[model samples]
Structures are given as structure tokens and as C-alpha cells.
Target: MKFQLDEPQGGNTIHRHDTRSVWVNGTEHRNSLLVPWQGTVEDWRLTRFEDLTEAHFERIRALKPELVIFGSGSRIRFARPQLYRALIEARIGMETMDIGAACRTYNVLASEGRAVLAALLIED
Candidate 1:
């Protein structure tokens, strides 16, 4: 679905998303990516939810977002606590959802000027 909103001047915002891809700032990205509310988008290099590791969570931790929206591809799959123990220890909040929901939530939080990160996994 396409999200109708004026793009914020600096921060990243999801403009559209379907099952296969997500559009950030009008650019379509088909692979996994990390979208920070106020930073450059980067490739997440995670193809599946199972690929998630402590190191991956650590990377998100380094961004220091107050909340994280984890898009577990096409469905809602919870990750083992051990995979993201660092986030729990750091007191950062994380919510897991399907990719589409994650996109929508990310847009809302970002528009509200919240420090949020959307770690979305898009299947090939």
C-alpha cells in the first residue's frame, strides 16, 4: 500500500510498502534495510528472521533508538530473547510485527518525531 504524506526534509519515512518491497522516501528497496527516524537508510543484510543474532541486535542498539519495530518478513514471528538480550538490557523497546504493519507503524512514529527504527526484512 502507498502512504500519502509529505516527506520529512531530513528523517527517513516509509512512503509505500507491499509484500515484496518497501519504498522509503520514494525509493523502492526489495531487500532488508534499517530505517532510522533521523538517519540514512542502510542495508540490514538479514534475509530471514532466523538470521537474526546478537550482533544484529547490537547494531540496532548502537543506533540508540528509543523503540524498534522489527518486521519479521511476511508474518509476525517473535525472536528468541537471547537474540536481542542487549536491547532488553539497554531498556530499549521493541515490537515485532508483519512487514506491512511495521511499515505503517514506522511512518506514524517517525511522523510524530519519535526516535524509532524499523528493521524490516523483505523476502526475495
Candidate 2:
């Protein structure tokens, strides 16, 4: 995928490439990253931890976000031991929360200049 960066003066700045990936400001996202009190994306990459693996990790690892917010479905559950260990070993910060909560949290952290990676599953 080709990634393009767009810097907006205000609100959430979205980066678009084709249609597979998007990033709000510097945050890494599969779909889109919503800025707090800003807005949301029509189609954002929303996923559960169970849907991720080392391969996914490797792909996202390239972004080098300080914290990766994992929306574990619509609930909060501890991430798999394997993933947790691997993420920690890679010095990647991980946050587990509900999908909606994750999205909100992601934007806040990203807007604050935190290296944030978000995986949120949202309903249209």
C-alpha cells in the first residue's frame, strides 16, 4: 500500500492511501483515526485481538506507534499471552478496551502526540 500524509490545520487530519489504510495525524490505522471532539471515519479498520497475529504485528510494527489500542470486541479481555509477550518485547505499548472506548482513547492519545496505534471495531 501507498501511504499519503495530509496535515490539516485543525480537526483530525487524515492520511489516505487507496482505501485500505488511513492515519489521523501520526496515528496508524487500517481505516481511519477519529480526533477527539472531531469526527469519525466511514470505514475504519476495526478488529479484535483474536483476529491479530504475529504477521499483523509485524506489518503494524513498521509504523512504530508508542501505544497500540486493541479493541477486544465490545468488551475488555486480556490479550493472548503470546501477543502480550511479543508486544512488550518489541517495546510496544498496548491498551485493551471496548471498541468505542478504544476509538475515543486512540484519538486522544494520538492528538496529544503520542505514538498511538488503533484497532477499533465500530458499527455503521
Candidate 3:
């Protein structure tokens, strides 16, 4: 799906998002990735939802985002709290949603200048 931004400044804009890809700043990304409010996008070398571990959340925590919008691929599935114990310990909140919702939410929060990260999974 494509998104039109009302306020396009202050952070990265998610122009389009789908099951296998997302367009960030007009460039298409076809992999799981970490989208920060105003920083370089990082590729997340992950394939399966079941493979998520505390280490993944810890990586996000290291970036120091106040919150995370975790996209569980094509569906909305919650990871066990144990899998993200690092975020909890760091006081960094995470919200789980389907990939599409996560993309939209990330754009909104990012435009508002909130410290947010979208850990979107583009799984096969």
C-alpha cells in the first residue's frame, strides 16, 4: 500500500509498505529492517517469527528508541514477553501489530518527532 504524508519532514517517511517490501524515502527495501525515526535504516537478518530472541530486542534497545513498533510479518502475533525481556528491562515499550499497521504507525510517530523504531519483519 502507498501512503501520502501530510507532514513529511522531521524524520523518515514510509511511502509504501506491503508483505515483502517497504519504500523508505523513495527507495524500496525488500527485507526485514530496523527503521529509526531519523537515522540509517538497518537490515535485520531474521527470517522466522519463532526465531525471535532476547538478542533481537536487545539490539533495538541499544539504539535507545523510547518505543518500538514491532511488525510481526503478515499477521499480528505477539512475542512472548520473555523474548523481549531486554526491552522491558530498558523501559523501552514495544507494540506488536501486523506489518501494515506497524508501517503506518511508525510513519505517524516519526513525523511527530517521537523517538520510535519500527522493527518490521518482511518474511518469506
Candidate 4:
């Protein structure tokens, strides 16, 4: 499925997404990546939900987002709270969903000027 959103004036907004890839600001990303509401897009090393770890969540914590939208590949799978204890302890909110939903939600939140991050996991 593909998603479309009215482009935000600045910052990153997820423009489109399908099962195989997510397009951010008109650029397609097939690998796991970090899409901050207002920052550089970078490749995330995690490839699957199982690859998630405290270290990974710590990275998200370092980004200092008010909330995080975790795109767990093609389905909705909640991560163990311990895996993201850092974010929890920091009081950073997080929501888990399928990749497609995450993309849509990210776009909405970003367009509304929320400090959100989309940590998307793409199956290899």
C-alpha cells in the first residue's frame, strides 16, 4: 500500500510508504532507518524486530524526541519494556505499529509540529 501526505514546509515528512519501502521527502528508503521530524535521515542498523536492544532504544533516547513511533516491519509487535527502558526512564512516549501505519502516523504528527521519530524496521 502507498500513503500520501501534504508536504510540510520544512523538516522530514513521510511522503509515501509501501510494503517494501518508505519514501521520505520523496526519497525511497528500503533499509531500516531513523526519520526524525526535523533532522537528517540516517540508516538504522536494526533489520528486524528481534534485533532491537537497549542500545538501539538508547540511540532514540539520544535523539530527544517527545515521542517515538516504532515501525515493526510488516506487523504490529510490541517490544519488551526492558528493551527500551532508557526511553521509558526518560519519559519519552512510544507507540508500536506496522510499518505502514507508522509512516502515516509520523506524517500526521510531523505535520502538526510534534517532536516525533519514526524508527522503522525493514525486513531484509
Residue clash pairs of candidate 2: 31-45, 46-120
Better of 3 and 4 by TM-score: 4
Runs off by more than 4 Å, candidate 2: 1-49, 121-124
Clashing pairs in 1: none
Give per-residue CA lDDT, model 2, range 1-124, as digits (tens). Answer: 7453333235454342223334555565554332332334333333444555665555545556667886655567766757556567779877778756676676566556666667554322
- lDDT tens digits by residue: candidate 4, 1-124: 6465466667898878877788898899989999999989988888777778899999999999999999998899999999999999999999999999999899889988899999999888
State every prediction's TM-score relative to the real structure: 0.91, 0.56, 0.91, 0.92
Per-model RMSD to reference: 3.5, 9.6, 3.6, 4.0
**Highest TM-score model number:** 4
Q: Give model 4 RMSD, 1 decimal.
A: 4.0
Model 4, which residues run further than 4 Å from truth? 1-5
Q: Is candidate 2 or candidate 4 better by TM-score?
A: 4
lDDT for model 1 comes to 0.90
TM-score: model 3 vs. ground truth: 0.91
The 10 consecutive residues of candidate 2 with the worst lDDT sum are 33-42
What do the candidate models score in CA lDDT, each in turn?
A: 0.90, 0.54, 0.90, 0.90
